[model samples]
Target: MTRSELVTALAQRFPQLQTNDTGLSVNVILERMAEALTHGDRIEKRGFGSFKINFRLPRTGRNPKTGQCVQVPAKAVPHFKPGKELRDRVG
Candidate 1:
């Protein structure tokens, strides 16, 4: 589900929590996660998954349309590794 959908679900699930409060709570959690990733930190949630960054070294890449060679810059990308419980549940 989308972010708004998640907030709505949380609000519905917890009747004591107002919709606004639920929305803020969700936003805070997501913002913290993003902030941690931005700082090159890893977040591991047991029974769920681990979030980390993978670095890609500079390399040559080709343009699909013209097949032109291009230099690709180094970059860090967010990566996720599912925990065993999550993997088993999905499977």
Candidate 2:
């Protein structure tokens, strides 16, 4: 779900929290997760999934429009692995 949808769901599930508070909480959580990932730290939620960074080595790629070969620079990218419980539940 989108951020707004998640905030709404949390607000609905917890009547004690205000919508704005829930929104702020979600924002804080997402910001912290991003910060952790930026620092090359792994994030794992049991029965849910894990997130980590993966490196892609530099490679040659072709431009789709011009069909021209280009050098692609290496970089780090985020990756997610679903937990067994999550995979089984989804299946």
Candidate 3:
């Protein structure tokens, strides 16, 4: 679900917390995740999943439209690996 939906769900689940507080909590969690990712750190939540950064090397790719060669720059991408518990639950 989207962030708003998540916030709503959290607010509903925790009746003592205000809607704004729930939103802030969600934002803080996401901000922390972003900070960790920015520093090339991995996050592993038990029974959930792990998030890590993967590097992509520079490569030459062809443009589908023009069929011309293009140089693709290297980049770091976020990767997620589901924990066994999560996989088992889904399965």
How well does each candidate superpose onto the true structure, as a TM-score?
Answer: 0.97, 0.96, 0.96
Query: What lDDT tens digits, residue by residue, belong to model 3 across residues 1-91?
Result: 9999999999999999999999999999999999999999999999999999999999999999999999999999999999999999999
Off by over 4 Å in 1: none
Q: Which stretches of candidate 3 lie over 4 Å from their true place?
A: none
Q: Candidate 2 lDDT, tens digit per residue, 1-91? A: 8999999999999999999999999999999999999999999999999999999999999999999999999999999999999999999
lDDT (0 to 1) per candidate: 0.98, 0.98, 0.98
Clash pairs detected, candidate 3? none
State which candidate has the highest TM-score.
1
What's model 2's overall lDDT?
A: 0.98
The deviation in Å at residue 86 for candidate 2 is: 0.8
Candidates 1 and 2, the one with greater TM-score: 1
* Model 1 RMSD vs true structure: 0.6
